[model samples]
Target: MKISAGMIVWSFCLAMAAGFTRSKPDIGVPVALAYFKTNAEVFASATGELQQSIDKLDDDPASVIKARLALKNTRLQYKKIAFFLEYFFKSAALIYNSAPKYEIEEPYMEYREPTGFQVIESLLYEAHPATKKLELLQQADVVTSSAKDLNALLYGFTANDKQLLESIQLELVRVITLSITGFDAPLLKTGIAESEMSLRALQTVLQPFREKATKTGVEVANYLSGGIAWLHQHPDFDSFDRLHFLTNYALPLQRSLQVFIKELQLQLNTTHVLNYEAGDLFNPAFLNLIAFLGADSSAQWQIGLGRRLFFDPGLSGNNKISCATCHQPEKHFTDGLTTSNAFDGHSHVPRNAPSLFYSAFQYRQFWDGKAESLQSQVKTVLFNVQEMNADSLALVKHLQQDTTYSKLMGAASPIDQIARCIAAYVRSLNPRSSRFDDYIQGKGPALSEDEIKGFNLFMGQAQCGTCHFAPLFNGLTPPLYDRTEFEVPGITRTDDLLHPVADTDMGRYPLFPMDYYKQAFKTPTVRNTAATAPYMHNGAFKTLEAVIEFYNQGGAAGLKLPIPNQTLSPLPLHLTPNEAASIVSFIHTLDDAEPTGLFIKKSNQ
Candidate 1:
């Protein structure tokens, strides 16, 4: 009498497939909400059954297999409505699941807890059978509750037309970028199948638009259908052509859908999450910071005043020092030193000076991630004894005496205004173009063949993109750059090639002592890495080759260091010499933007 979890999911998918593509007679908020509520119960039901299957697991091989299949089915069911779920009800979506190689933090949560589907998937898909059965049960319970919450949210949800369209567009992005890139199903490699289901759901969403603009709608539908069919044909995700998918399919679809939106006369809505123009994929507006700042933020008079303060030595203890002392713009805002010389010149700064280019784009700042924003990071450098070694009050007094600074900066203390201006200036350094970015935006010849190959390896075999992620090539996980991600990469003190010095830096642990974060540090952007090295938080490697080798050997695990929770896989990547070279070539293309002169002044000048 009991229905299997697979049966439950299949039935729902079949129902969705049957009715979803029919071009629902009515196309409005109430109808969309109604359609969602009608189908929402199925998602919760499948998840509950999945939890039960997981709880029933023990020594039996059959039971373990059953649990795994149920997990897969439950995942597919969620994919059915992932777009709408993630866009409107993000808070509830977190409880359900998230992308891999990243940690998420919710605003109201007391403390960060590793709960959700991916955590369960990791345990289920482990090489060895589940050892911690109790932990699996707990996670399954959380999934069940999260699903129930999602259904409740759906019942109360009232999405406007613009919001609905925005969700559809964002979903397409998540599909090709995150889903197709094999980000969501890291352990299972089920991205191909999951993407198919997601695309099928996408087809249903577009059916309503077909009523308004038949030709544009048909074009979008063809792209979606073709993309889904392509995914099915190329089942082997390891060899999947992500570039082709992004450019030929996903990019075209985005443009077509934009036309459809215009034809329908729906007001163009923008979101801070993915405010990119469908005209190009590499647009900087894709970045949350760029979206928040807008195109005109850089030209603000406050930012202009901040630029002068950055090069002025008044912010430092001695009039001889300035923000540019260590952060040279010509060197991509880095000093081109392993550890920069301190304001006193005798001592060295504790950490390597980071690039200001795209520095303000992240959710947090600094290698330790102690500073919450670009302004706070500036505050730390200005006051830290090893750096500027200046007092805020004294600096304010000194800046106030400067007639130009006092006149340009408003009523706020010169120091505070300077920090804000500096922050704005940093944000203005955001890069919208790179050879690799150009390639993604459909200029295929922008990157060399080897560099393109290397990019493929980085995303797939090299495991670099899993942490670095796309676009930013940093720890800000896509679909939503809401929280920052830090990892215990176990970077040694030096790249000795042999007898490498062990990394003793207790990253993030000083702030909150969690076992996993012991020696964990923030993952900075690899964008200008070829220029920004010495690499890692400690400046261990002098060259990109050495850095690649360190990761190839498997981070702390490869070094035989005792980091139980090292996020990086210790297993050797088995990358050939050419593969590594190609990766370096790809990284080389990340340094595309030229240095703007405003932040590039020499001390003598």
Candidate 2:
């Protein structure tokens, strides 16, 4: 039964008057087992239904529809245990929730085609697999068998109070970041229903942790209950004010849960993608540290050494080029050119420099999503002949020659340390408090009415939020900033949006050769869009308005580019000129009033 808002408040107050306590009930291993068992049962049932439907499909068109519809029920059942499964049984969870695309298998996993609820959904609904319907049923059988295997594997599943608390909070963040945002059920629009089911699961796991109805328990109970109730009330997909949802309900829910856990002195047992013990999703420290995952150190002194190397021309062969030659800080780290200058200076470099601010927020670096880490990105630029034209050995020798460099940079493998340090310096460049951030944080006057309306549109009909997600407004999806996302937003090589030709650059295809990744590039942060110009991989769009219009017209696909599987949904946004301007206004809010760095001139660097 759903707890009443008034009853929760009353309970909280009465319990508060009575005071709080930290003692726990016996940890519920059985609850975890039951959770796993229920998922196995549900997946098996769904698989059976699908098999039966597939059998009837030879004669009845309705059977295909029935099979398609049946998957939703199965999905909801899995959703109830989605976080629980993904938290522990991540490899097993992939059989249900993997993306409907080809993927290179991870080291431990076998190479296989995409097979999941989404793949099944697409086959039945979108792909219209006429001759392959039987093959689809075979996949269903495999999924069912895997679920049974997973059930057996989970026999030893256990959780202490700390893991339980961590899971719930992490799951709560997932609800706001992924669930309510429609990230999970992108095809079926079952995200809201799934979230409700997840909430029910949350209520179940958390029921045992009432701390004997003390104030701490009441607070946790009230917030979780209230969040669930709010979701129940706002069931519709289209009209849900997600911005309001995040600020009013979700933020409060996160805070209260933290307080509940802290008050109970729940010791953290493990760290997640945020890599911190607490894994506090909304904390600034968590936000800042996303980029600097593995290094010998991220000391300010190292960062200072990096800054020095950044401007020092000795890193280049002719003692003329430095990183700052192209990545000028005042210009948001871009050189304000269509493309950057080559080492020879007569010709332009291949691609425009992406802004350094918030660049490290995601694991994948570079416009093409080539480099896996920031240090590797530095290495790419250093040796790329077209860029800095410096060698690791030569740079280290140069570093040894400078007394100041030796003093600042540790007397070790100087070039490698310098590269890591430079990456650290780049990591230090963070987003300044923008108007949009301020408005979301409750300083309402930070954004004008038009900008506010624009934000709503961005999160709503414009489909910006669907791709460029919140907080960092990049592809590192919320709760865990681990996997970076890539998109093929069919764009032309030239600035002429009307006479479109597919941008010849095969973006992520070089790394992961697949049809979907053919023209797909990394989703870069749109934070300083107002400042950084000549957008796209080829630097085609010179103005933010032009970029907005490109998206408004559904990218190059809308411009009649023959892109079959262009990842950007090729549907015209139908934004009015005023509406487009409003979106631009909202984008402007992402710009720092001044770039947050020690500004240096390109000539000096």
Q: So what's the TM-score on candidate 1?
A: 0.84
Candidate 2 residue lDDT tens string, 1-605: 88999998998888778855344554644675576577668767776776677656653567767776777777887877777777777788788887666543321124546787877776665435556777677768767777666667666655667776777777876776777656656556666777788878887777766746878678667766776787788777655656666666667666666766676688563543453333234444555464334433478878887888888888987788888888888888887888888989799877777788888777678876777778888888888889888976677778778876765456456667777879878877775567766666665465677776677667666678767876677877666565677777888887677677677888778886777778877788889878988787778889988888888898887787788778665667788999889889889988866643466565543
Q: Residue by residue across 30-126, what tens digits does model 1's lDDT show? A: 5567556655677888889888888888878888889888888888888887887788877777677753334434211134456677878777766
lDDT of 2: 0.72
User: For every model in order, what is the number of clashing pairs?
Assistant: 0, 0
Please give the lDDT score at residue 529 for candidate 2.
Answer: 78
Note the Cα lDDT for every prediction shown: 0.73, 0.72
Q: Candidate 1 local accuracy as lDDT?
A: 0.73
Question: Residue 27 in model 2: shift from native, Å?
Answer: 3.2
Query: Model 2 reaches what TM-score against the true structure?
Result: 0.83
Task: Output the lDDT of residue 542, model 2.
Answer: 92
